[model samples]
Target chain A: MSATTLTIQRVSPDAIARVIDDAPLEPFGLTDAHRRALAARLGAITTDHHRRLDSWLVERGGRVAARFAWSPLAARRLLGSGGFRRALRGRAASIRDGVRDEIEDLLARAASGRAHRGSLGDWLAHRHPAELALVQASAVEWARILAETGATVTGDWTVASADAYYDVERARTTLRARRDLLVLDGEVVVRVRAGGPTPSAGPGLRADLAAAAFAHPDGRAPRRYVGIWPDAGVILAVDGTLANVRAGTRDLVRATIALHRQGELRAA
Target chain B: MTPTTTPARSILEDLRGDRSERPPRDIETAAGLRATLDAELLAIRSVPARTSPLVISASDVTHHGDAVDITHATSGRLRGALIGQLIRLVAVGHEIIDPFDDALRAWRLDSPSPTLIAAYADLDANGRARLATDVAAHAASLRRALADVPSAWAVRTAVRARVPLAGGVVVLHDVVDLVVGSYCDASSSTVLLDVTTSPIGRSATSLLGFHAFVHCLRTSVVPLRVAIFSTATGELISRDVDETWLELAANDVLDVARRA
Candidate 1:
């Protein structure tokens, strides 16, 4: 009687933007005319803040079924942790305005030499209990949603601590292995929070993302990466395959870091 | 040699004003009793003014991350630190609405009162007839409860008597129980005694609050009696506590806080 786990994909900001742009704006089971009218209204503010408007939509038979707004605070908190460092550093471009300030604040604090000598996750935990609670709740929500989707999880999803350095990658992969569910091969949805790096599709961004992924708590090799600012309705999507979820999560995290680094370079 | 004149004066005065059932026990005449009280006071005073260990239950555990969770042992340590600090604050006679805030003041932990008094004043449904009277009564109660207890004199009296030092139990509708703890005589230096109980309004938070109070006594202050009562149910439970090791523990807590 294991619970179902969600095999989530960190969708690139660009791809996410496109999906939001192209999606028919209507509730789950709208008529053709109603969907068309709603689409027209949604198409107006669909460019920059598209990901903020982007939500989780479970599709069945070409129809949007269940939808939930990704928590911007939760996503940003994840980005601040060592677990999301790779995804954060992977971004080669810019993100939404709202998230940009928050990410910058965190980065600035880290750059100011206050970052923990150990892992970022430890730093976040010690410094931000209330905010981190939201991130934890979000992770739990992800597990709950996957369980609801009928994917039986074989093991629990967990983040390895700084003290448990050797088991980093194995930990993330375990989350996906829960209940013996197939790790989805297709695009995994990623909704960036407001306080993350901006989106850009550039070649150099990949290297920066790899570097950030290497620094993540999972500490795995990089693959495809994506960045988004869901709060601002923007997404930066890249395509790649990781050896496992740990590697993938790290690569995706790095992409965000790269974007922030770029922003720092421009400011300097 | 002077018994005929000076001692006769006391006998004559007693005969004229009052009657005695039996001769009073005099400390000067009773060498054993005098020696015992002296030893008890000295032992308490010698218990370096600070340090007490904190005990924690199992409820504080929670999951944190993958392969990470909060443990009861850690929580106990934290609770110890928190209570130790609170004792130090209350010892120095700091008046504060929040005990947590009270501990924040520097040098406030030097001499804290063993007994803490808190008051809640509620308006009665007097339709302008006895409004002033009710209001004055509430104010008087508040003044008495929060009155600055410069020392643990009243607490010592209660402890010596093994009774509620706050006078006869004043049970409240909202309060389920009340507990009182204090240091006593040679027999029970650190004793906890239950004072009163109500039949309703008991909760974990209340128990924890009293536990924290004992924690303060055990660590940075004195041998204490801890009484716990519920606001709703009024059931009371008490423990005569011996926290003589608090002095060493407070040093550890200080070191930890500095590092943290």
Candidate 2:
């Protein structure tokens, strides 16, 4: 499988802007055949056989899934919440100073019969001052990194959705699309990770690129896919090219096939 | 009588140092040290490959006295862990609401150990009260030390540095309790601070060196200084990072790696 070239660098905090700005501007256009193949491959993995494939089940894959808790960790949830996005929209100084208040508001909302059991708000509602401090500290670090990106404080960035594709016949199984933050009107796709780059980071990021392409509204992938690891002080960028997206698709297909075979084996 | 200086104030003064003193950025030294350590470490017998890399932490280097039983959760160990969590809380500007409750909450959030949880649960009311009182005292000490971390310093708590060496054969992991300043600064301005529940000892100093060494390996920039504040006895120990200090740290790691 042909993979997109990956560039990994240990970037200082101040240099993050240059890395994002320097990302390649090549457009990634998908043909009718590509779309059909993606749909068929995704459909084959669905558990159900009779339901139509509708709506996207979007998710952040690779390190994002491993690092961010889909379950109980309140700090990770707060980082990816709508509240965090709103905080980003406010004055930068307010974000640094008022993180605790934001957390308190989230906890209050969770306690007031608004949040479901085991939700982000529920988990936060039970947290003590020390745990809240972790959330606050994480926010401070995140704000510092975002400030270095040189992006406008207002509506330049928005959280991307995780899309799911189900089998047309049976609606039981679903294939979720991997994505995270969409910046500059989806010109650049960003995945915020926790740690440093690893041996599998290249393929994982390509999978992210493929997932983003599959969910693109225009059938055109973003010009660049960027992975930022704030803790490790590193950034990885991959141009959203045809070969790279194809490689990512191949990865997803292979993974799905393996899972499908496993399910069948279990049943037999 | 003159007013007594608090440990936290002393640490802050030492950390601030001479404002006009700007340490030169020595990337070449860091690179050389990393190359030497890499060559020496790879030359040692490699551990058998496994699914996960073998991790080497500061405890691995410092704990040479007695073989700590992995299964037992001692009160001292629990107190240390609890105090460490509280220090992180104070560093982030969180006032300690209830010391024991906050520490346990932070600990659970970070890593919930069933063994530790069961141990804490088994404690009687009096035992639990004593623990809480101890935690409150430690929290007070920590609050004083970390309360004034200037926002401009860009204080980051629980800053972890994981340096995987020998093609991921062994990973050196260390977490600085607090970091002041940024690596992106023009001068050598980054300062690594560690908070310990126990008094600073010989082992603690060595651990500080180990932290500096691993940090340099990860960031390619040596921090200006490394400091440690002990909540146990209100003691502060600090040392500047230099080529000689890094060399000693590299040698210590080599010695430990060879033994392993």
| Index of the highest-lDDT prediction | 2
Alpha carbon RMSD to native, model 1: 27.4
Q: Measured with DockQ on alpha carbons, how good is candidate 2?
A: 0.33
Off by over 4 Å in 1: A1-117, A120-183, A186-205, A208-225, A239-268, B1-260
lDDT tens digits, residues A141-180, model 1?
Answer: 2222222111121222222112111112211211111011
Model 1 per-residue lDDT tens digits across residues B1-260: 01111122212122112223322211121123223333443344344532321212112111112323221233222222223333222322334343323322221222223222110123234422243333233223222322432332111111111101011111001111111222112122222322221221233223333333323321122333344322222233433333323323232322322222
State the weakest 10-residue window (summed lDDT) of model 1 chain A: A52-61
- lDDT, residue B229, model 2: 78
Q: After superposition, how far is residue A92 of candidate 1 from its true place, in Å?
A: 35
* Tens-digit lDDT string for candidate 2 (B1-260): 01122553546556757757967655667668866777877777355435676677888777775755321236666777788777666655676778889888778777656877788788899988888887788788877766665544566667776676666666788888877765556578778888777666667667888888887776667888888777777777778888898899888888887777
Worst 10 residues of 1 chain B by lDDT: B157-166
